[model samples]
Target: MAEHGRRRWRLVLTASPLQGHMSPMLHLATFLHSKGFSITMAHSDLNRPDPLNHPGLTFLPLRDNLSATADFAGAGQFLQTLNDNCRPHFQHHLVQIIDSQKEASASEKESIVVIHDNLMFFAGSVAADLGLPSIILRTSSASFFPAINIIPQLLEQGRFPVQGPNNQILDNEEIVSELHPIRYKDLPFLCTPIEQTLKTINMIITKKPPSAFLWNTFEFLEPTGLTHIRDHYQVPVFSVGPLHKIIPTHSTSFHKEDTSCISWLDKQAPRSVVYVSLGSLANVDEKISTEMAWGLANSNQPFLWVVRPGLVKGFEWFEFLPEDLVNQMKMRGLIVKWAPQKEVLAHSAVGGFWSHCGWNSTLESMFEGVPMLCQPFELDQKVNCRYLSDVWKIGVEIVAERGEIEDAIRKVLVGKEGEEMKQRAIEIQEKVKVAISHGGSSHNSLEAFVDYILSL
Candidate 1:
């Protein structure tokens, strides 16, 4: 519960422009606002949250470089441009906010703190420069958190840049004992050149670290990973999440959610539909898309597929579904440009998810007790897919071939194997509910986080 008569704390949050980064930060903002703190979202001009979606929070715009709205060039370039360009603008803007607040009457005044997504480390630096406390929010799972710094470790050992025409580290196939069960190949794929990757890594961690890190994960999900982070950082780390369930916030989606898919789902039988979405950034090969369409049709299970614009690389939209198989897919599938994923997952018709294994989608699927057909694309997704399939035993991974795709979808939706996976998922879903309840781990952690903030 929020402390009574303590409404003078104001939080300044910086949200990264990517869809994946924007989401969890906004949910955190909503969660904090409910605890009686005022929120000011300092973000790039592109992909700004709709003020109507979050009524109580304020949105502040920072100047943007052209790269803000352009297609992602690469990981390092994107972060370098965002951090280098936004640093001075954000610093100056924060100074102005601090000065303006000083002029207000004491009764109307509020103390300030800077909280931001992990990628936006520049915010913490700016805050430290002005002598204010700041916090960092990790948008991915706790298990995936420590794996992020692995690239630097590999580089130090002189084994990176993966010799040869194909991308394979010297120890790509070996199980890393320190990482336990994850191979070098399975570490989050850094999409930038080795030098750029090193540069990006150095930039984010070399600064004075934040006061705390707030993870969008709970103890039951990845206790070991959480422990690794606490030992490594030696700072206050809070696991107060599955925040979507804690407080249901309005859509921070970049695309308009197509509600029409819900009606298609309504017409299907219970536990009969396979839901597919590849998230916002992953691009599939044209051949793979064609094969996936045929594979879904071959599975004979009813399915709802989100084929958003740019799903097939170099194409405007997924209009290239082979003219021959179009009729077959129409008979048993509903295709939409986008979907309201949380609602779709909860619907009785959705029995399985064929996903790119993005962290947000992974958490949503887990929350609804739906088994997953994991097809991790890159970066943190590979780490998440590994845990879901190996650690949790609730997901089935698939190769990109049509025959394998069909079999995996069936295994999650209709076969006895799917039933077993569904049961395990249901068990975890129940645990999730308990974690957010009174006196639970996540619940207590949230209380601790609040007290820590108040103390600061």
Candidate 2:
């Protein structure tokens, strides 16, 4: 109700306390705000966005009582801590938001909607208790979201908790559905105990179904997964993404991004440099770090490598690079604490990415049409690498050995096979550009999402 037919829709959004989760959530909020909706973002105190940095959007930090260091333990522990400690704070703030909306005058009163990241299951509960329309945003691919639903079936079939010597169960691929062909290795939390898997399953199932599902993936990228989710779920599913392409924003890194890498890339030949980064959370042990260093040096190709602090276990920063490897990297490679990833990907010199296959990095590389050398460490990274290598043919996965890493780099950077992979990536890039433009699938889906929120 508005005095002069003015729109007064307000959205409350919450994301899990992780860099990957927060980045996309911020982008979505920015997009909605641009579309004439007022936005309020509830975030964990750790890694909270500065409210001053984002005008017209209110930022509320929930007291989770956990330090930022909690993230280093891994995804399972971080998620468990959030669920255990953040619920009361989240609920209390949500009630306050609802009360504030109710207190407004009739014409100025806003129609409140809640959008929460899939990992923040508690937000959904609060939304339901308050009778607000809630939308669950799966920041990863549509494929990864449905996989969690079938964990119990996998457990019953003795396919989960991937037991036995060296986890032999992961070696065999089973068709979960006509849409999803998965191996045990692609499942997240595979190394964790069955109790952890059960807890995740229970958490997902116990939540009341949201009004709709929002995915940060395009239709062409995950057709079968999208189809399966749409057919199986009762709510409407919207696939409107490569979110970065749709709404380009500044660097959202918890650490500072070194833009000097762009200047370094300027000196390299077009498509001759490989960009390597393992993402925010994936850690490489000392041995693997050493192997990677030598492998990159041996590749003899120009590279821009981001060696973040705490990336190597039991060592500080770039201390992992050996003396000999440092000499080799002198002219051929540039190592920075962190690089502006999107800028690096878009640079002409960068041809392939050595990445952890985090969904954000995956989408960014694809959008920029750069081929990838995927070294997925955990979580949805494995599933995303499967799609990149097996489904899309835009990238290749690397084995942990130094020789394999060196070979993968050469294959992607200078080999004839890499040219064809680059072509495929370019095609995907064109399709993504079209999808985010006017009269495209993702654009229409986003409009539909807005319309649904208005109707509510």
Candidate 3:
């Protein structure tokens, strides 16, 4: 009964089972859905406790979802396991779903187009098998793409670990400590464990096509990196971002955290509250979490903290805070387990952010012109933090991790040095806003990318 050769090719958004991986893809899915593209977002039944429900976007649950691994450990182990398990199961599940969808929609000749996470290596094969056009959504910086794509090859070629005395994979401590310009520490956390990292990279190198890459950065921010990818791959790579533009012109509520958090911000003076959140996916061991809490408590500044459930390690640790500090923070601070981040960042009361320097957080903060207190954790965060401090001059890093957190907060919040960073951040915010507005690079790239997708 369907119109011949005129069927809409529904987009299937396939993501790895992590919040950081999913959020930006969902942001794009939301955009495509708004533009009237039918979207079926495939998620791991193995992961979500409560699956997302969007009106236009269909959430298709897969049996044997890759996220359900029996060997789940702490955050570090879990991510590595996720990296390992995701590829095989996702690839298998994708083939099954496509075959099934094709049968059901057989009357219509239109096939599917997959917008998949770059980390999901299996999608490349599945796309080819089904003769579907697949785009690898590189949600991280374009600057990091070459390093990411070549990591496995580099290990095979002996380009990295150039000067280390030991086989870099064997010397765990040496890997974290040595390596200049970008240390193993600065590398994405997975790269710190070189053998394990090589496994992940091998998957990428073996499966990815030259023309399949799509990054979440605009030309203005990462022209050199994008150029590097193109020169090396000899394929078209798209950079369409500050995806924030496609989000509702007015924000929508996504998290169930206390709404009062916004009201508290309303009461605070404009650009006065320092917002603190390490993206939902990253977890600090108890020591750093305690240090951060004490640092914030001691700073005595108004703050809004997003403490996602289970992000903190130990319950007993919260008792270390003096009751007086807790009272003071309660009066001046708003602590929610999860937040609608884009909304909070866009709010007038938020002056700066204390971030873990995840790419999404970094881009969103930049897009909002919110300066960062860069406390980088694993992975590409170190590089993202460096860009903030060295390239953009919109943030500062804490030199001494142990005792300097309080000083870092005070410096970004109220001190004379803080004033300079504050002004620079606001200036950057204006730049970001303009770039995403009409006639901006991101805007132009977005239209072109959509056109490409539509053409397929």
Candidate 4:
């Protein structure tokens, strides 16, 4: 903590433009600000947070030629473009902020640190060039972080680039050292071609590791995964998260959230509604979207669904719903473009989450004690879904077929099996609350992190 007569230290924070990445990063900034550090946010123009929303913080929006709507062929390409386009802007603004702080009175110029999203590869370089300490804020699980570090080993063993008879490589359940037992299919960024994979691997491995690695997860939630990272990597690691629980007022959604769904939920019975959303970026084909609609209708369960504008390929928003399907939804469903997700999960009527298992959503559901019906779309979501079902026993994965979807929903919302899952979810929810409270594991870790930043 800063002394009464001394000036507060400043911390500059940056994040990738994506919603999932930006949300947690902002929450972290809020948490640190509450701890007495002056906050400075450096962000790209794409999906930029309104500076007015965060009054005490300094907001720097960096310029980039890339349009927010520019189409990338895939996630890897998008990431590569972000790094290329944002690097100079980020570095330039970062330098300006550091210099500005230096010009402040000696007490106010005590120290400055940079904490950046792990995906913004250029942040580490900028920190080094400026001779400042930095920390990497990993938006995903600690379990998923080491996968990037082991791509070389996987290639040497001929396990990655995942080629084999009949695409059999995806079926092989090999236990990789840093990760839990997983098939090739569960690997993060697996859809990227081998060449792109190598490029990403090189980018990550070549960078100077930051002074500390901060994960948006609690120690108890992923003990084994945390241990693996600490044992293999030399940098200091801190697990100080389920950040939504810590900083609830920080808004991170790129889209305006609809809070009206809470009233609809209030009309339903406890543990009856299945909350459905596919996150901000995942798009489903028309076939899968149609199947999901009918499946939800057939389950005879009330639901609150978020159908983002571009959620379905080649269809207008909710126009893809057939007339009869629309009528059925009117009877038992509520649809919105975007939802106040944390609020929806906390509602009494929500029994389960039908989700893409994005880490933020998963943690939110866990924090609320809502079981999941997982349909993992891509990247770390797949890994998170694996842990939800196999390790945590709080969710069940669903296939895209109507029958499979219906069955999974029925199992989670009605049957004895569903009750068991709900009980487990509630148990985890209690543990999460404890972890974020004072003197809890996550609380202690957060305090330690603050102390480190102040010391520097």
Winner of 2 and 3 under lDDT: 2
Q: Over 4 Å off in model 4, which ranges?
A: 1-8, 97-105, 164-179, 204-207
| Candidate 2 residue runs with Cα over 4 Å from true position | 1-7, 71-74, 101-103, 165-180, 204-207
Overall lDDT per candidate, in order of appearance: 0.84, 0.82, 0.68, 0.83
- Model 2 is weakest, by summed lDDT over 10 consecutive residues, at 1-10
Models 1 onward score TM values of 0.94, 0.94, 0.82, 0.94
- lDDT for model 4 comes to 0.83
Arranged by lDDT, best first: 1, 4, 2, 3
What RMSD does each model have against the real structure?
Answer: 2.2, 2.3, 4.6, 2.2
What is the per-residue lDDT of model 2 for residues 15-92, given as tens digits with 9 covering 90 to 100? 986778888888888888888887989888878786765677888788878886644454556776786677797788
User: By how many angstroms RMSD does model 1 differ from the true structure?
Assistant: 2.2
Error of 1 at 27 (Å): 1.3
Q: 257-351 in candidate 4: lDDT tens per residue?
A: 99888988989999999999999988899899999999999999999989999889987588977998899888999999999998898888999
lDDT by residue (tens digit), candidate 3, 290-312: 67766776677788888776676
The residue ranges of model 1 lying beyond 4 angstroms of the native Cα positions read 1-7, 67-73, 161-171, 190-192, 205-207
Q: Give lDDT: candidate 4, residue 346.
A: 89
Local distance difference test, candidate 3: 0.68
